[model samples]
Target: MKVFADLEEFTQAAGTELGPTEWLEIDQQRVNQFADATDDHQWIHVDPQRAADGPFGGAIAHGLLTLSLLPRFMHDLYRVDNVAMAINYGFDKVRFITPVPVGAKLRARSVISKVSALDNAAQATLVTTIEVDGAQKPAAVIESIVRYAS
Candidate 1:
C-alpha cells in the first residue's frame, strides 16, 4: 500500500499511479448476499443453474456489486495518514465495461487524476479500473471523488 503523510502530500502526487490492489474473488455467496441486500433476484446474478444457459454462461455478479468494491480496493491501494476523516464524494463517471462471472478474481488499478483544495479539506479525483483476472477487458471503470478533511 502507498502511504501519504498528509493530504497535501497526496495532492502533490497528483497524476501518480497508485498501482493495483490484490485480487479478490467474486463468488456465488457474495453475489447472493449482494442480491439479497439490494433485492435484485435476477437469475443472471443469483441463479447458477439457470444462468448456465443464459447470456454470461454462468452466474455473474451485478454491475453495482462490482462497483461497490471500490472502497475496499482503494483501501488496499493507498492511504492518507494525516486525514482526520474521508468521505466518498461521488463518482464523476462510471461504466460497467465487462461482466464479472462468479468465482472470477478481480483487482483494481488507480491513478490520481486531479486534486483540489477545499475548506479545511482536499478533494481528489481518481480514475479506477477494475479488471477481471485473465480477461482482456476491465469489469468496470470509474472516476471516483473523495474528500479528506483535516
Candidate 2:
C-alpha cells in the first residue's frame, strides 16, 4: 500500500497504481442478504436453482453489490493518516462491465487519478477496477470521489 504524506504527494502521483486489494468471495448468503436489504430479490441474484435456467446460468451478483464493495476495497488498498474524517463524496463514473457469478473471487486495483482541495478539505478521485480471478474481464470499473479533512 502507498501512503501519501499530503495532498501534494497524492497529486504528483497521478496515474500511479496504489495497491491491489484482497480478493472477496461473492457467496450466495451475502447476495441474499443484499437482496433482502435492498428489496431486490431477483431470481438472478437470490435464487440459485431458478437462475440456473436464466441468462447468467447460475446465480449472479447484483451490479450494485459489486459497486458497493468499493469502500471495503479502498480501505484495504490505502489510507491517509492525520485526516480528521473522510466522506464519500460520490462516484464520477461507474460501470458494471461484467457479471460476478456466485462464488467468484474479486479484487480491486486502485489508481490515483486526481487530488485537489475541496473547500477546507482535500478531495481525491481513485479510479478503481474490480477484476474477477481467473477471468479475462473486469467485473466493475468506477471513479470514486472522497473528501478528507486534513
Candidate 3:
C-alpha cells in the first residue's frame, strides 16, 4: 500500500502509477448477491447451470458488480494519513472492457491522473484499470475522482 503523509504529498505524486491492489476473487455468491440487490437477474450472471453453454462458457459477473468493487480496491491500494476524511466525488469515465467470469481473480492498477487543490480539500482523479487474472484485456477501466478534506 502507498501511504501519503498529507494531501500535498499525494498531489505531488500526480501522474504517477500507484500500482496494483491485492487480488479479489469474483465468486458466484458475490455475483448472486449483487444481482439480487440490483434486480439484475440476468441468466448469464445468476444461472450457473444455464450459463454453462453461454457465450463466456459460464456465469459471468455484471459490469456494475465489478465497478462496485472500486471502493474495496482503493482501500487496499493507498491511503493519505493526514486527511481528515475522503469522499467519492464521481467517475469521469467508465468502460467494461472484458467479462469477468466466476471464480476469476481481479485486481486494479491505478495511476494518479490529475490533482487539484481546493480551499479546504484536494481532489484527485485516478485512472484505475481492473485486470482479470490471466486475461489479455482488462475487465474494466474507470476514471474515478475523490475529495480529501484536511
Q: For each candidate, give its TM-score against the true structure.
A: 0.98, 0.93, 0.97
**Regions of candidate 3 where Cα sits further than 4 Å from its true position:** none
RMSD for all candidates, in order, please: 0.7, 1.4, 0.9
Q: Could you give me the TM-score of model 1 versus the true structure?
A: 0.98
Query: What is the C-alpha lDDT profile of model 1 across 1-150, one tens digit per residue?
Result: 899999788778788898688899999999999999999999999989999999889999999999999999999999999889999999999999999999999999999999998888999999999999999999999999999999
Query: For residues 22-138, could you state the per-residue lDDT of candidate 3 as single tens digits?
Result: 789999999999999999999999999999999999999999999999999998889998889999999999999999999999999899999999987899999999999999999
- Candidate 2 lDDT at 31 equals 96
Candidate 1: residue 69 Cα off by (Å): 0.4
Q: For candidate 1, list the clashing residue pairs, or say none.
A: none
Supply candidate 3's per-residue lDDT for 71: 93
How big is the positional error of residue 92 in model 2, measured in Å on the Cα after superposition? 1.2
List of clashing residue pairs for candidate 3:
none
lDDT for 129 in candidate 3 is: 97
- Candidate with the larger lDDT of 2 and 3: 3
